[model samples]
Target: MTAIVVAGGGLAGAAAAAALARAGRDVTVLERDAAPAHKICGEFLSVEAQASLAAIGFDAAVLGGHRISRLRLVRDDAAVSVGLPFEGLGITRRRLDAALLDHAASCGAVVRRGVAIRGVDCSDGLRLDLAGEAPIRPDMLLLATGKHDLRGVRRQAAEPEALVGFKMYFQLNPAARQALAGHIDLILFDDGYAGLQMVEDGMANLSLLVDRARLQRVGGTWTALLADLVKRNTLLADRLIGSVPLLEQPLTIFRVPYGFVHRPTANDPDRIYRLGDQAGVIPSFTGDGMAIALHSATRAANAIIAGHTASAYHRALRRDISGQIRRAAALYRLARMPLAQRALFGVAGTFPSLLRLAAQYTRVPPRARSALY
Candidate 1:
């Protein structure tokens, strides 16, 4: 069998390569970054994500991830807290990705770092043009660039993307840590929400998803926008009272398409499989994007091993994940509306099980029952 080439060595790519190589298939992974580093992510691992990681043999607890058992939603002075339906973990992507890539390498997959895919030509086979290197043609290609698009295999253009995301890591004070331990907070404001959870290394990850126009109107700079948000969001302001940023600048990504789901096209000829954010973009507040990425990789690998067509795999994946994506999208829209946000909070406060129900609905279905599996 010819070597399978996976572009963008992220969670999806590395996981897919590891699974394929372990199955005795030759696999090669192309990564743009030379080393493991932080990416723009919420870093909350759902129960399904944990299961997938365990299936691949990397323990989140062993890697210093923090346990998260509760969900806290805060808006103005009103707040609602409920136990999560399942145990979750908070771990930095840097640590997780590094471990996964190492696992792939150990499984005999050729892990090529510092190589960016310039474009792909599939007229003959699958030709990958790498940065500063000769083209390589492989038997199959997996696109797992997360939020990025390669030169020739971009997603179909939809409506203009207007969501902007910002992320920062901070060392919280003792009191703040005590208050936030074992919990993930979703703090809502005018046009966005910030997800806060303590990851490994004893630092808090604060990820924000906001409307581009709203952020621009507030100030247009991270510091200014944050200050403006903090002024109106008392919960976030309290959490940051004595915290200090771990980095000099916050990570930011613009034009985030929060509800995108890619469908298979009729004209496609390449044996290309799209994974993770390349396949779909769930609302960040739902906190299952990583789960989707990891699970999708496993499913894709299974399909490839079973000699399934790329389109067939794509259709099955869409069928499996479309409900979660749609439900999350509806919640995302409702959460952004002020009155609806207050109403939902009231309902959750009165019947906390509703929140748990939503969580169950948004999760990636168990792998055993998954169609692709």
Candidate 2:
């Protein structure tokens, strides 16, 4: 049996593997994808996220992250621009994931790419049935599969009307890129929202989240949905008019449990650790998902190194971010309502600092940020 097995080599798994292997533990990561590719994300790296990655010896700036220092919120002809408390980065998940996995490999963790776990059985201990290779019975299994569930190892059900995500890269016309420079565009509609920003290579990422009913109403096609949105939302239409979509279809993920936070339950395996999206999922509107994924993995790794139980680690994670998650969820719900959005926009237009405050409160507490290492 391997000493430790990490499932899903995205942000969480790679970070955990690096931390564990750097500490001299035998760790192996099983990744489904043969290589790091585009992921459905807003691609906004908050200040806290940069700090966490730097603490672990990964520098996103060195990876050519685009600068983001402002927030532009729009609601159909009404828009508010505010300075961010700290400048963040706009980088694609593909670059970030590859760098972290390479770091893990350099730290002596074996990364097995093109490998997918068929199922997880923790009946006696932790056993993973792989697609091609023989099953692995590890001393500990760290679940970091980020929004996707493994067979036989179930996660808590998502909230009703769970959000589905779609992301497409576009080469924006010069005017549009210049207009979006240094700012993250957050365009809100009735049942969904979209985040637009410039990433590396002069490409713009347009990521969207809409509920199931909204998708069905559009005949379950992103193109049709986007066309309908353009007809209604002049703001979105203006930004996308001259942009050339780079993908045949947007990368998509369904039933995203936006407000999920995993707690230690009675049936959870004692030696199984849940990291990243397996641990919690903050609202995407908060722009802290990537940071939470990185920090939670590091935190869980520390817990395991200290001989702590999975339950203890989960409890600590809950303590750290549960309040923030709840606050984010409330704001997300409010932002979806037209009346609440008008009130929010009015208040934000009057007191722009509230926008920064909303960003602050929906993240890992400030008190805990400095101690992440």
Candidate 3:
């Protein structure tokens, strides 16, 4: 049996594998996709995420990420702009995931690309069934699939409502690029919010989180929904009127439980550590999902290596981010209402420190300097 097996090669899984391998523990990562690609996310990495990446020996600048220093909130013609509490980066998942996975391999973690974990048999230890190979049981398993559920060990959440997220890359013209440079713009409308920021190669990443019912009302097609949004949101129309899509179709995901928090019960499975979105999903607008993933990976890897149970790991993770998750959820709800959104922009404009406080509160507390390494 292998010492450890990790499912999903996204930020959480790769970070875990790299940490464990660097500590001289045998680790293997199973990735479904043949190559790294874009995912449905805001793609705005917060300052905490930057620090987490540095702790793992990965540099965002090396990945060609664009710097971000301001936050712009817009609704109709009224807008509010404020300097970020800390630095941030706008990066594409394609570049970020590839760099972390390559770093995992360099740290002696066996990264098996093009391998999909069909299911897991946890009767005795953890047995992972690969697509075209015999089932192998590992001493421990870490689930970090990031919003994609795996069979036989799918995560359960208590949240009843969910949001659908759509993301697309665009080639912005000089005017749009200049307008969006060094800033992350968030446009709020009825029942949804959209984010635009410049990423690597001077490309822009536009991501939206909308109520599922709202999306269905706009004809259920990405183009239709986006077109409708442009009509409804004047700021989005101004920024993206002439932008060109890089792909034939925008990447989309459904049923994203925005405020999910996983709690382990007495009957939960053993020897399986849940990381990233599998553990808990903070609101995307907070831009702390990536930080949570990296921090969870580092903490869980350390806990497991020091002889801790998966249940303990889950409880600790819940305790760590409970406050941040609640705050982000409240902010998400407030943004969904047009009146509340307008009020928020007004308040943020008047009291800029409130935005800084919100940013500070939403950050996942950094691990101890000695404990992190």
Candidate 4:
């Protein structure tokens, strides 16, 4: 049996491994982290994302531990709540990663936890250097490394520089929890936005997405930036003023670029495929990153199953996500413009239902609704 090696056993990697295993491919997944950890993610899965997972046979039990419901958008001091045309799920990355990894393993993929991939050499096949061991070569390579800059991968020069994001978990009061339950509150300001929600364990997830420039202006420390951000936004300040942080430290990452590869084929003779953030990123505003990754993984697996060439697979993946990417890019551009941002809030304040209408495209699935409610 031909074997495929997946680097980075996060959402994309685990999903890709599961898809491959389902297709009868022998798969190995390498993850740097051990079981059960949180990622600096929004933790709120949209309805569409949940639907995608359900289609892949993801277990509903994975989402059983949290609240589920529609999202509430807040702008200009006005809040608009809408039922996700579907439903959204909220689970900590700690729970989510473990569940995904377990699912991958159950599907017959070999998962190597605490194994970091040091390098990738794509020649006839792909050679992966593990931390202190001889390199292992596999028949095919899937780079789901996600957001970590690889030495040899070529990136588009025109792509916007990736922004930095920081998130920390917190235990909230019943009132605070109720305020956050079933709603992903997006607090928008100039240069960045913060998403607030309740996840598993009665904890609230506070995640911020900001440009590198703005982050630097705040001295590049989560403490400094978060303090300044709270001061600037009264809603956040009111909610978190005396709240204790659950994370020992805030999670941060930089330069997360989002775009499609004009060409997906590995031009470097590695025949290696990039998945998720490794492939390309979508803006977090849409909250579709994981969905895009899972969707792309399925597409890639199907292409390989049909014996399609790497280039052909790339084309198929591009075709699938390009439209959404284009729309996201346009929205990003608008968000960056001061007048547009103000105008957006103004309109949102006037027509609260608009936010709900916009969220329809981003709802989660029925099976995972408990987490978000």
The segments of candidate 4 whose C-alpha lies over 4 angstroms from its true place after superposition are: 154-162, 260-262, 265-270, 360-373
Supply the global lDDT for candidate 1.
0.87
What is the clash count of model 1? Answer: 0
What does candidate 4's lDDT look like per residue over 1-373, in tens digits? 7778888888878887888898789999999897677786887665555655675678644666555566666544556566655556778777877888899999989999988878776554567778977889888877787777555554442555557888888877666777776677887778877889887778888888887888889897888898888777666776686688987998876666655443554464435677777665777777778777776676667666777766776676666666666667676778766689888877877876776655543322223333222
Off by over 4 Å in 1: 367-373
Deviation from native of the Cα of residue 291 in model 1, angstroms:
0.7
Full-model lDDT for every candidate: 0.87, 0.87, 0.85, 0.72
**Model 3 alpha-carbon drift over 4 Å, by segment:** 159-162, 366-373
Question: Model 3 compared with the native: what TM-score?
Answer: 0.95
Global lDDT of model 3: 0.85
Which consecutive 10 residues in model 3 have the weakest lDDT in total? 364-373
Cα lDDT of candidate 2 equals 0.87
lDDT of 2 by residue, 1-373 (tens): 3499999999889988998988999999999999888898999998888888787677889999789999999877888999988888999999989998999999999998999999998787778999988988999999999888899877785653556789999998888899899999998887888999999999999999887788889888998889988898877787888889998889998767767888788888888888888888888988898888888888888988889898988998888888898999899989877789788888998999999999889988876665556
- Which candidate number has the best TM-score? 1
Q: Per-prediction TM-score, please?
A: 0.97, 0.96, 0.95, 0.89
| Cα deviation of 102, candidate 4, in Å | 1.4
Candidate 2 clashes between residue pairs 3 or more apart in a chain or in different chains: none
Better of 1 and 4 by lDDT: 1
